[model samples]
Target chain A: MPDRSVAGPLTDPGPSHPCGGTSPRTGEPDGRPATAPGCNGRVTAPPDDCLARNEWICGAYLSSRRDILWGAVLQHLQLTAVSVLIGLVIAVPLALAARRWRWAAGPVLGVTTILYTVPSLAMFSLLLPVYGLSASLVVAGLVLYSLTLLVRNILAGLRAVPEETRQAARGMGYGPVRLLVAVELPLALPAAMAGLRIATVSAVSLVTIGAIVGYGGLGNLIYSGMNTYFKAQVLTASVLCVVIAVAADLLLLLAQRLLTPWTRRQS
Target chain B: MNILSEAWSWLTTSAHWYGQDGIWTRLAQHLVLTVVCLLISCLIALPVALVLGHLGKGGALAVNISNIGRAVPTFAVLVLLLLTPIGRFGEGPTVVALVLFAVPPLLTNAYVGMREVDQDVVRAARGMGMTGRQMLFQVEVPLALPLIMTGVRIAAVQLVATATIAALAGGGGLGRIITAGFNLASTAQVVAGAVLVAAFALIVEGLFELAQRLAPGRVRGGNTG
Candidate 1:
């Protein structure tokens, strides 16, 4: 892998990374040749640069890789958001079905649990046959992975709704859908939001695994950087991944508090 | 259907079960990696959680830290370690990343378990003649067993799943089979590799569940004869 990492990025030659081309910000030539002959016939940054030194925290690496980094981050966000949203859409019905039908509870939970345990890599591979080597492969795998968490929490929230609350809504001439939408779902928001937060953060983390199939977003950068032993690229991309996870969690937590203002009044 | 048959044939072939990169060898590597990481993680996490839980202090800090730790991607940690000075050593980076990965759940679960032990029970033990150590080892631990067991079970299953990252870092494991099959574009082999790993993980999860069930009634709490 180490040997391949060194040779891997060199072979791409796609000008994807701005380090070897004109700066996106300045639109000026980089002055030096796009790529210099690296040690052992590999293509590397121009001599005497931070990259040439292979430094771990090079600012130059960040500035040069900005476009690439931004693209990866966007892709990462897209993957996480799409999958988690789809998971929620699917989970709502599963949760409701599980609530409404006694028999569905076991099978829904059972299938999702099994899906959750299959592992990120194997999950993707299993879906490869279905989605092939596309971004949907990653999204589909993530949606499946999110199911167990989403379904369980949604079901728990629904179950916690008091029978009295349902009866009261029913007595008011509320239809079944109205009772669920107005009465039940509002009460269930805290738990569902909690599940959503976890699902989102985990999706952020797992999106990187998509790099293997070329849909990894930040994972693609991390994988290639590690291969070439590109320290700054590895660290920067990783820190960004963590930041995204934290930010997503915090945002969801805030949303939960706002949506379930009553929950804040409690201990 | 064709892929399934191909994967099935691959699994049944005696040729795939022997040699350097064989299923047996990869499974052993994967298991060894998982066990070693779990041991190290348990050693580091359990005592801290137990003590913090027992003292009823610093537990919030520990739990908060573990929650933060959960948000960091395991893959990032793996690659970062590989790019650092630690990457030079054989499996050192993988071991370090996995140990770090396994710690949070173990710490959080165990700590929460200890804290959630009924306060009345602790008060009664204090009211009795039992020492602090006796309370922790006997009464408190017994009461906390179910939650602690849940934590350990979660950690073990997670380790089994995440240890596959080892192959990406040039370490050994069943992940190599998947990566290898991937490189060769052999979908059958990839499916077979996925099956091997998925099955291994399920077995591990089942075994942990069984262990928890079969544990002495004392460790299971309040059910002792």
Candidate 2:
């Protein structure tokens, strides 16, 4: 509720007029002991030195920190993309194995479920000693978290291919791997896509937790903003994260539509 | 090897288990936060979802809107709340953030569960001279119990995991141990704290799984038509 109200007008830029007021100590360069005029008490002018480094208004902050922000966004995208991709690669084989060997499904799903349930913060800290605050630590945790969803969905998709279809494929002299790739994988696209959407968004979110170890995407901006009490920086970074998540989700939905036009027509 | 040995030593150190900052105290605090948030989220989300489900109108919109809550990071919400005036009160901001985070699954599952109940069964109950309330409670609810329980289980596990964020916002929880470890640069202590949180989540997951199994026979392990 508070987040909604706070973030609601993030893109409006109507507050830019108020932030233009000259900071009190701008002449002294330190900008110390000054209140930013006109802007709701949401922000205080950082020391002029800090202000020079980081812009004040939301728009200016975007432009001023564009390089850093873009880098963070790219990093964020990379983190989510790489983690989900890796998870998908691992999950497909595991799901296939589970399908072929029923006994393995239980233990495999159980292990992933446990990994998924581990709190992100705890998982990160648990690996700190072994990985020493590296991106690999975050990626490992994220990949594990994505496993439950990815594997379940892939299996569901593969299973959702009617038994008759599998039987028909076999009757056509298709071998196991060929049948899987040519027949099963195409049919399983929708479910797998759905899983991808969820995993990507979730990874985007979990990647922010990596900020604790100083590897977060927009999360770094959020942490800095909180520490410095810069409302613009915090709001901007948070908004961008939500934006990225929604965009990624929508793109996947479109891909699903393109891949499964039959489902769309039926719907 | 050194890390494991250090972790074991840190965990075994009895002094870490007592006092205000001890593992026991933080664990209790974490449990309390999680349970309280879960209860509050259920109270807020369940009735609305159930009633909407029973009515079979406007439920889709409610569920979709709540999905947006899932998209937003709980950590971002927590930080945003702490910036607002409500952050002044003890535990208020953390509770609000956690409750918001816990809502979407509970709301979605409860609604879907109710909707998934057999229509013929509802009609049968009504034919037997049952009041709407009676039909809802005696027929629909029992059928929907499994899914409703599933939602609760999900919310419970999620709350247990996310409650660790409370320490970041100055609220008490097991996360304090991790943060303290970070401050002290004691990797063993951090690992120990992480183990505690992860173990607690697994235990909660296990308890909920047991509860699901222990549901009434008619409602257990059977899909509603």
Please report the candidate that would top DockQ against the real structure.
1
Candidate 1 pairs with clashing backbones: A5-A227, A210-A216, A211-A216
- Per-candidate DockQ vs. reference: 0.57, 0.47
Model 2, span B1-225: residue lDDT tens: 798789889989999999988988998999999999999999998888888888898776767865587578777777777666677777788888889888888988889989989898888888999997898788888888888888899999889878886665466788888877876778898898899988999999999988778766665646444
lDDT of candidate 1 over B75-143, digit per residue (tens) = 888888876778778788889988887888888988898998889889999999889999999887778
TM-score of every candidate = 0.91, 0.88
Q: Candidate 1 lDDT, tens digit per residue, A85-151?
A: 9999999999999999999999999999988989898888877777878999999999998999999
Model 2 lDDT at residue A77: 90
TM-score of chain B of each: 0.94, 0.95
Model 1 clashing-pair count: 3
| Model 1 misplacement above 4 A | A1-47, B216-218, B221-225
